[model samples]
Target: MICKAKAQWIGYPPGSDTSKAWRTGDVVIGGAAPQNAKLTVTGNIVQTSNNNYFNTARLYMQSPGAIPANGQTYATFAGNTFWNNDSAKWQIANSDLTHFGMMRFSATGINFYTQTAATSAQWLTETDLASMLALTMQRGGNVGIGVPVSQAKLHVGGNGSPIDTIAQLSANMVIQASTGGRTTDRGAQLEFVLPSYSNGTNFWGQGRIITVAGDNIHGNAVGKMIIGTRRKFNKLGTGSDWYYGDDIVIDGKGNIGIGTLTPSKKFTMAYSGTQLNSTTPITSEMVVQASTATRSVDTGVALEFVLPANTDGTNLYGHARIFAQAANNTNGNAAGKLVLGTRRKYDKIGAGSLWYYGDDITIDETGNVGIGTLKPTGKLAVNGILLAKQVKVSQSAANWPDYVFTPGYQLPSLDSVAQYISENKHLPEMPDAKEVETNGQDVGKVQQLMLKKMEEMTLYMIDMQKRIDRLENENRELKAKSNNQH
Candidate 1:
């Protein structure tokens, strides 16, 4: 509801007389010049006859020889209907009308009816007539019937038409309508309507439309599709964000992401105790070798057949291949398992053709052991103890025998050696019989005395022999000296 007007009035086109017209009403008042335009009414100006023709009521024009300039023209009055019935009537043609018919106060309560007198009259608002004649006046506009209604809607036609309903406006227009007024049409209604497209021009409005058409439908819309330029995030809508394809989301920073950040997807290192990992593939011929430190499975650890218990039978068979190399530097370490296809008596057991060399024997931390086909060179040290086993010495290519006792062979038991001596009525084979003989008298006193005496006599005999040798050497030296003197 904004209206603007310049205060000062200016002259119109020259020679096009700026004179005004008159109006007919209760008490006709006129002006002083041709441009005089002031009309007022104190009573109703009504029809004196039942005549529907536009009535005419002549009001006196401006007085002659009066300069209409510098006159503040206006009209003011009020009254009820003034009528004239009978043949004798008073009618004046109201042409060259000017000035709005002003009514005021108690006399302004004027109504027009039943005119058998005044034939023609024109009652127009001041601005209303000014709008029709294109006059330079303030706040004047034409009047018309609004759509779907018959109320006189005043409008500045051709210049400023009256804007009443919301349907008459376009986009980006500001409209103020009555909040709850009941009219056939009130608020704005935006719709897309077009007939069949006959040309490229028909598809476009004021500019070219940039859109993505899929499945014969307008699906995605972009802002400006500049030709030959790469497509960016060139579209915007009601919201600040944009939607990508399904599941891919764009955030405020325009960074498109697929998955969450916390507790991210990653690979992990796994550990095992006595067995392989649960996710490891367990095969039929495969085995996992466990290690205490590092929790690793060495290739050396494997399965072997445990000897069955069935009395003292010497025949058994468990044949398999050894696949791992023996431990390096360390003397007794199990490389892998060994399989004996058959067994024999203890005496009959000899070296076989097959051999797996290491320190050639395996002794575990607990002194449990296995000797491969190749015999070890010296005594096997197991858990800080020396293991005594028979050694086979090759005399020739075809002559090799198992071990026989020597000077330092510790008997398995003293009773076993005693039994051997008692049964044979002789000592077991000894490499040093004199050394054993020297030990005969160490158990009892009689033997100890005899041993003492014998030891003394042996010592004396050794000293006597040494003296004899010395005398002979001395005599030889004397004989040589005598010969030299002779």
Candidate 2:
């Protein structure tokens, strides 16, 4: 156990005869010579000066001169005025010196345990040294000035039993586990029971003291907490897609946020204070949006919207939504094929002639085919249904054979006289290659009488003869007939 001395026998400059002091093979105070000394102890010593008065304080370790190579020094000291002058004191050689404590320059009387013979060395192992330190701290009791805990208790067994030993624990006492824990009838058990609260006032180790139900505080305060500068909240990497100071407020089931907290919401460019203000909503808005600038939408292939060269594995392989423009086989052997399947015999679009066993080429309702829009110019080559309308091969092949019209096809711009002349003029069998006959019928009245005689003449010869004679006489005879008939 530690031996404590206050040295309260005040004297002029604190003087006393060193001969009155105690000496041991392990410890030495002011020694047998006359010096300023009093109340010396050879064993573990706990000494404290009162009112900051200490003079000619000295301590020395007189271990053997020879120390083992690579040997360690174990020591501990702590005090406001603690100092040491051991810079040039250690002698290193081939002997062991372990477990030295308190080599401060200010504190005097180093306490130690050593071999009685000066030639022999005494050293404590780690466990022994630790035990001695515990014992010393336990015997020292409470210095009891400013330490948080003034006293502690060491219990061996049951509570409040007279047989159970209770030792007063010092304020600075650090009691270590003797052998870690204890073994009982119920295997190895570690039982820790906290001291009961002496008064109605609560203590932290038992019940809760002051709990922070909501926020403890807001804004920045010194030492209150600054989630260290090295620590980051949103750890978005060094890409351009990261945003900071954007807050996300979530409800019990929903979320109303300044910046979009949910993936289906929008984000606003505006910010309120350090927080982002909720204005616009972003459903599919991506921070790093990827799109196909060439086409209006993204096609999941590596190819651009327009390609310079066909990207076939070896030959010409088109990817998704593959399109061919003016693509044809040079030899016309139909070796050019668009594949849309794995390596197996399958239909691409369609095959030749009638009984083609292949996929059907479909025209969508919007008139688009394959993967894009289809626009026909001049004529559209259709493979599906065709609606038909009647067309005349020759307009001169009339309502009846006797009703011969001159110009084969009637033009839309033909006037009344022109239409009559065209209808009455005897058209040549090949009007396309021959001149049309426009003579002898009254061109003006021909529009009226043309239909009347068109039904009257049943014989082809009579019709031809009458028209030819009328043409031979020209309009001079035609006008007389018109007037007489009228």
Candidate 3:
């Protein structure tokens, strides 16, 4: 019914006052108030509709609060429950019903949906909502994004991507001052604060700081990165400073420095540690270990240093690799062989790689060392000539030449020695040139043989001296007899 009341109009059932009405089919009021007018309702209103009803609004609740200000309107359902008695779904739609959203309430949970197309819609539950985007404070009060079990105060799940989890980005990932201001000391920084304890002793801690910046100190603009450490206290009177004047530095050219910032090589490490003050002193500070227990065919470990192939704009020069490898070659019957050598890529495009002459130094499983070869048959084998300052050969007492001076020793006569040398062109007990050419001479045995020859020559000289003494005495007596006859 339409109401055109000047002040107010009260309606009621028949034979009943407006305050107490009992007979009611529906009490509907419809009116259009002028501008700046208010229509207030203090009772409840329910709109019932049929199932699958489309393009209908069950309620158009609006509230335009105070004038001369931007206002908001919302519907409030206070102290009321919505129970869908049947399985009939209640949906809210636009006037044409082409795009709509739905909400369903059941004993299990509430489901919210949004139509994706004309006939398809995506539904979401509480678990789906949590997985889609998470903003959680865990049991330990750690806040996180996309991480339910946070391990830090502010954790972000990395999602197994290349970029960092939490990144501050612009053209690049940067933490800088605001564009509106010019601040000389504005840069990204990560600080570590250590805990303090009350005790008679003081404790110092160490931390690392890394920085990346553009540098043009060498007249070329390039990126320079440095990693340094800070110590809270040290031997220099308990004051903190950057350690070792920048512990590590990497330049645009890819040169790295450990202790010296001005690195001369591709990788340089300078040691400035304490000097030795004990009986056992350290001569070297660096060690590279390549260890393995079980070795098979084509399986080994090595410490290799490789140099890239050098080129002069067009043609390739060479590449060098130096490695110390411990290998067990089942095919070659070599087990536990240690080889230290260098290989070079100096062949032509179609040829194979090459190694410099006399470059390999190998020690076999039996401790026999070989130079310029992989397999060694003796204690020391060298394929090339060897130069040394001096050589010493040790012999046992039984193998020495002192037995040549004994009384029972047999000495060959000069005529026998001459006949043997004339026929064989060598000594009786010594090797010939052809034999020496094939098998190298044994230094200790050769020295002993030479000593025996010297001792036999001394015996021959003593026998000749005795015969000369008798001839001289007879000549003196014959001269005395001739003088007495005269």
How many residue pairs collide in each prediction? 27, 10, 0
Candidate 2 residue lDDT tens string, 1-486: 123234333222236533243322232354543222233333465545444466544454333333212343322122121111332222222223322332112132122222223453444333333233221122334322222223543312112334433444332323333423331111211223344467744422321111011222343111110111111235342445322322333322333444432323332332323324534433333232335333321121222222223346354322223222212323422212221212213333543443212212323223343321133221222334546695233323334333334435332222553575587664222232122232222322443345434433333455578988888889778788899998
- TM-score for each candidate, following the candidate numbering: 0.14, 0.19, 0.41
Clash pairs for candidate 3:
none
Ranking by lDDT: 3, 1, 2
True lDDT of residue 208, candidate 2: 16
Per-residue CA lDDT of model 3 for 1-486, tens digit only, reads 222333343455566654542232333335433323333334565655565765553554232332212241212222221111122234444553444444544443343444545653343334444444344555555666555456787766644544434333323223443423322222234444444456634443344444444452443334445565564544242566534245677766789888665677799888755556633333445555445444453345555554444454553423333344445544534346676765544432325667442237878788899987777778998877889999888899998989978888888999999999999998878878888788878878888888888888888888888888988999999999999999
For model 3, what is the error of residue 309's alpha carbon versus the real structure, in angstroms, after optimal superposition? Answer: 7.3
Tens-digit lDDT track for model 1 on 1-486?
Answer: 111122122333455656423323222324223223333333454534344673754333222333223542222112221111211112121232222222111232221112122433444333333322321211222233111111233322233335543344432333343424323212222223343356534532222212111112233211111111112222331344322211222222333333211112231112223343353344323355545432222334444444543468544433333333333434444333322223332222345554222223454333345455232323332223434585343333222111112244333344675797787665444323565455432223343334444544455576679999999999999999999999
Deviation (Å) of 124 in candidate 2: 22
Please identify model 2 stretches exceeding 4 Å from their true place. 1-15, 18-22, 25-244, 247-258, 261-486
lDDT score, candidate 1, position 142: 24
RMSD of each: 36.0, 24.7, 14.5
User: lDDT per prediction?
Assistant: 0.33, 0.31, 0.55
Better of 2 and 3 by lDDT: 3
